[model samples]
Target: MDTAVTSTPKPVALITGASRGLGAAIARELAPTHDLLLGARSADSLRPILDELPGATGWPVELTDYRAVAAASASIARLDVLVHNAGIADLGTIAESSVDQWRNTLEANLIAVAELTRVLLPALRAADGHVVLINSGAGLRAHAGWASYAASKFGLRAFGDALRLEEQSLRVTSIHPGRIDTDMQREIRAHEGRDYRAEDFLTASTVAAAVRNAVDTPRDAHPTEIVLRPF
Candidate 1:
């Protein structure tokens, strides 16, 4: 008897917060093979990067808005990978944090991730795509005056874990990347000082490389989660 063989399809990846920092890095790293849909709140920020990459489309959508995310998701074809890297870190203790600050943190970090995943799950399921959640070390450990940001990340970690189980066939990984020297980290360092050591910081490109590795790994194998911290 003779057996037939088939080639697998090239994957498509949709990344949130692709304007700059880690999101932009992931887009650049994945541009070689994946058809990319880059989503962010600012169209201008994405235009230059999208212009440089091939087979990449830029859609400016606030992930916090479920309707906008849903509409944006509808415009895309089947997705082979989903990277949820868009997040905001608002600094404040639980008591000192304003109500608006807490709301904004939840909206940007937690709610947006959940809603965007819900919107994009169908497309991902159709292609057996992977979902990557960009979380933070704050999620795993407590810190001073980091209540809102920490809570948001913690929620995201739990959400990703639960979703991974629900989508047993799809690959879902939550990554805890310690202090990357992005604007986000700069802000945190400005307030925290030596607490966030400058020498012990990873570049956005490094995190992007990790994301690419996760996506490029064999489909038959799934790495549940990865914790990447600067050594």
Candidate 2:
């Protein structure tokens, strides 16, 4: 008698802004169990992460480019997870902010996210996927100098809330992490004229672990939100 062995196909996860920082950490966390589609603005930027995780494929597209985003999302027939992590934080007070600054911030952080999620809805529905939005503490509280960035994040939180209610079969989680110790955080510190201290902020891996835990939660429980702040 002959016996046959079958192997299960790994789940697929697409992570935007996966070339570095928290996005890259999330990719590393999920790489062992999920086949990854790592998104970055350019193939050159995504190369190092792609090399590190041989199982992942590069998805190079500007999120603000709706045409490019739609084209890229079309190739995915069944997506198990979609992590929206790409965003910009051009910090400025309302008095200092220009029309162009607000437009660019909203375009990258809010509009692009909505468009990408909209285009990938069909694929997500097919697999009863989980959508993870890497939000920020700014989403919950607005600081004086962070008007534009905070507004965009607040809009994102609303989007996630609406999505969770709208898509009954899918799970939508909004992860509100405080200032993380990432390259972005370094830039933010520089902008504020504060000394960069990695110890003062949440590590990318710690936040990434929170994401993985949410993704791994039992279907019976819905992890709608996860808030992480450094102690």
TM-score of each: 0.91, 0.99
Clashing residue pairs in candidate 2, if any?
Answer: none
For each candidate in the order shown, give its overall lDDT on alpha carbons.
0.86, 0.96
How many clashes in each structure? Answer: 0, 0
Using TM-score as the measure, the top candidate is 2
Model 2 local distance difference test score: 0.96
Candidate with maximal lDDT: 2
Local accuracy of candidate 1 as per-residue lDDT tens digits, 1-231: 899899776678889889888888999999888878898887888987788884788879877777777887796668889999988888977788898999999889988888888888788888887999999999898698999999999999999889988998789988888889887788887777646655679999988998888888887788777898888
Task: Return the number of clashes found in candidate 2.
Answer: 0
lDDT of 2 by residue, 45-88 (tens): 99999889988999999999898898888889999999999999
Worst 10 residues of 1 by lDDT: 190-199
Off by over 4 Å in 1: 1-9, 193-198
